[model samples]
Target: MRHLFTIALVSLLLAPPAQAQNDVRFQVLGGDEALRDALIAASRLQAVTDEEDSASQDIVAAARSDYARLLAVLYEQGYFGPDISITLNGREVAGMSPFDRITQVRSAAITVEPGRAFRLGRAVIAPLAPGTDLPEGFRSGAPAGTVILRETTEAGIMGWRTQGHATADVGNQQITARHNEAELDAEITLAPGPVYRFGTLIPRGEERMRTRRVLRIAGLPTGEVYDPDEVDRAADRLRDTGVFTSVGFTEIPNPDGTLDVQAELVEAPLRRVGFGAEIQSQDGLTVSGYWLHRNLFGGAERLRFDAEISDIGAQNSGIDGFVSGLFSRPADLTPDTTLELGFRIEHLDEPTFVEDTASINIGLEHQFSDELTATAGVFARYSDVSDNFSERSVWMVGLPLGLTWDSRDNAFDAASGWYADATLTPFTAFEDGGGVRATADLRAYYGFGEEDSTRLAGRLQLGTVDGGDIAALPPDWLFYSGGSGTVRGQDHQSLGAMQNGVQTGGRSFAGASFEIRQDLFGNFGAVAFYDVGYVSEGAYGEGASDWHSGAGLGLRYDTPIGPIRLDIATPVSGDGTGEDVHLYLGIGQNF
Candidate 1:
């Protein structure tokens, strides 16, 4: 009884304090105008939306205090004055009025003073030693504009380092103003301090894999000058070995102005399996799979197997089956010679059309140097086709020879430079009807800017397939265009010489395209392109005189897999059929 009485007395004492806290509530008056003024002063608000049912009334009290603090801030910032008033039940709230009111406002603008343009007043080059050849274009008396400054200053210094002067530097000497408002004068100086030569060639981590063949392919010499391009090439050559996960080169500069380049390597998994699926606007759906073994026989040999199935988007859909085998050796079978064997089988069906082909090829590849590779292969093919227009089978054999010169520093992310490859197939076929099929393809790219993000890539392809009558030719041997790879405004395999909406076979076809890619907004990019192509019955004949040209704009999204491309093209010249637009969704650049 005594404890219970004590408890009752304590509860009685705390009851009043709790009740007073619960009754603590204020009504906020003035509508949107007051809220706006409060927001302008405080920039943020802390209001309780669920306070109506909250058991803890402390939150509501805190919210009211925050509101009152905002009002106080407004008064201190002079946003409120006598014109703005706060009253409760016809009584003004003390200390709730602004100190001052806003009046007139003003803005700031930029103004440029008239002056002469900047010009190159003089140029001088200081070589590390006498008799060092300074390349042309790095001279004084040249213009001092941004363009000239870049070519003579930045590019010049880089060029000197590429040649052997690894410690080269450039500085502006003097500045003078001319009378013209757009003209100024300046002097440029260059210091090619010292020429650095390559040190010992050391292969780290994967010495056994970096055989003589790989070193030869890298094209890096111990006595040669230290060049960034050469280092990059060596890295690429090592990667091509297919034996390493990652390969890179680092240059360590010496106090004597010499640089020691180190080639670092990491071993990679020799065997891999990959699978992917794609959906296309034109091709509809495709599923692909591949299996690769880099060291098939443990001597840096490679073997790959690939399979793909596609459903073309059209009234007439087709299924294609392909099986291929490729075998190669790293070393020259006979000094300076390499050997390759290839075989393929294909089957296709579209509506009432069906075709089957089998081919076998053998080739010899010879590498004269790191930049040049030549291959000559002989192949025999048997093709059979059955369609509404014709049903025929033919066997043909030919020898194709090709040469490739790749000097580009990067294959996947090239910022500058170019590469070229040319192939020619010339021979007679012993089939139903025989003729020559020849093709040539060329591509180039050039990068601008310090980061090499701005680039221009161009391509040209010319081919001729002449044999038998048009009706007697195999369906697979015919040439077709009009797609993301050709003209974007046209349909896949639908562009060629046509007669009354029907394909009239042509003996030759030629195409050329150029694209300029500019990086914008981080990983996003924009592209402008032009394409032209024509098909002819004979070489340079009037029958093929009608050529079509197209121009378009594209947006690119750089993704981890590659570049996602979206293109919209319009036919610029041809039969006036209004305007045609095509949207392409694919990976990598169009080129």
Candidate 2:
């Protein structure tokens, strides 16, 4: 007969009865402090005995069930033999019958005597798959904890399953305890049913999305060896399209040594609309809204239109507005590729220039992995400009190439990981010669302390426009500093390069920012930040340049979508130089 005890899952807390009270006192003998605490926590009597309305029958039931629960806890800690006793009002709970229940209960006592800890005499598992790694403590002469035995067996089973064995499981397990020698012997065997291949992918529960598009988006590998990782990746690809409210996969075994995958999906609503607003002391107010259609033609194509107005009630600049539209189709050329068509018309009124522009772009974005993507687009644009320079109408053609890598924990409020984006655009003008513009944004975050209560984040931004004079290019394509997005404490576009005694957006720019955030209490947090910016008339900070710095403190309130942010800052160096304070309100982190 097996000497080891069998463990079963049991609910630790029982519902309290009304109109009765009972006190529970627990003790553990012949055990260390850690063992005593574990036994008390595992006992059901200790979980609910303090309830003010616990009935006598409820208390008795809890005390009776605690024997198995406490024994299981002891076995996990290498204690093979344990003596457990429970009494109600000095009467043994084990001897009482359910039919003979007392009307009221006063007090209950639980005592546990954990015997000597055991060590493994022999631990073995046969025929493990290649590259299977078991727990470090699963070797002979180590502490004979039941958790180690369970983990060792699970690792063995999962190893075979990764090698195209879909039905791998435990064949047999033997666990024996020798009380006299304080030793345990554990042996396990795994059953790898068969090597299977992928048969077909079937979609279910989809109402609006076409079945062919679903297959294209998922791109499940048929006629290939069944891989659990591939199955999971297919599910992730479906979810990333944002057309499904819920997505899941099920495996069906076939008689012909193949596995059929069933994709269950719940399609989301076709249309969505949302709006957002942000305000800064100098930059003024920006309000934007978007409308999106998830399944425009029943093939998971997304059509979206966006509009924005900025510089409302500002002291420095006139109002600016734009309307833009984008059409995107997934799996256009490859399973990971998306085709994009975009159109935009905009009017800009700034301190140094006023312009109207219209543009159209066609592009392809390819997702190389979950964290990396590359894009290439060709655009045609027309712009009419009026500035200190002569007014002119310019027509241009450009090619934009970009790459992005993001692994942040949260895009809105990241606690860890890195994000980087780089874009380079080359253009040819109808009247003037061609030039190239390049920009990059990089950010990193690290979290420490309990539950990531503290985070340190940093960002770097760089921009340069080369192969043309500063006055020859579109003013909006140039760079400006001293705003909420750069140096928060200074006026919007206040710092720029000087050419011909006139201040204008820079040909080169560089900025760096850092913040330390700490959780204060509840959903509230505090942050301290420092920012520095530089601009020059020549590319790559070559010609005359100026530097400015700002420092501030902010507060944050967490929400489901993101965090509500409020910041107050002032200039610390260069122009303004600690003279004025600026306030900003927005959603999500400053980055």
Best by lDDT: 2
lDDT of 2: 0.88
**Residue range 1-591, candidate 1, lDDT tens digits:** 999989976765554221112222233233335544544344221233222433223332333344456545433322231132322223233342432111211111111111222333444544323434444534444333444444446665776777777767874455454544323344556777667877655566664464555555455666766776767666765676577888777777777655776667777787889876545455466677888887665556678777777655543357666878777765546434657887888887754457898989999998766778899989988878785556787677888889888776766645565667777776454545566667777788899985877898888877777555556566666555555666666555455554233454456777889889999987899999988777765543335435677788988988877677777777777642346665566666776
If scored against the real structure, what TM-score would every candidate get?
A: 0.58, 0.87
The best candidate by TM-score is 2
lDDT of each: 0.60, 0.88
List runs of model 2 lying over 4 Å from the truth: 1-121, 133-151, 177-185
Residue pairs whose backbone atoms clash in candidate 2: none
lDDT of candidate 1 at residue 355, scale 0 to 100:
83
Give the poorly placed runs of model 1, Cα more than 4 Å off.
1-237, 246-265, 275-279, 315-317, 333-338, 349-353, 367-371, 387-389, 406-416, 444-456, 466-472, 498-504, 539-546, 549-551, 570-576
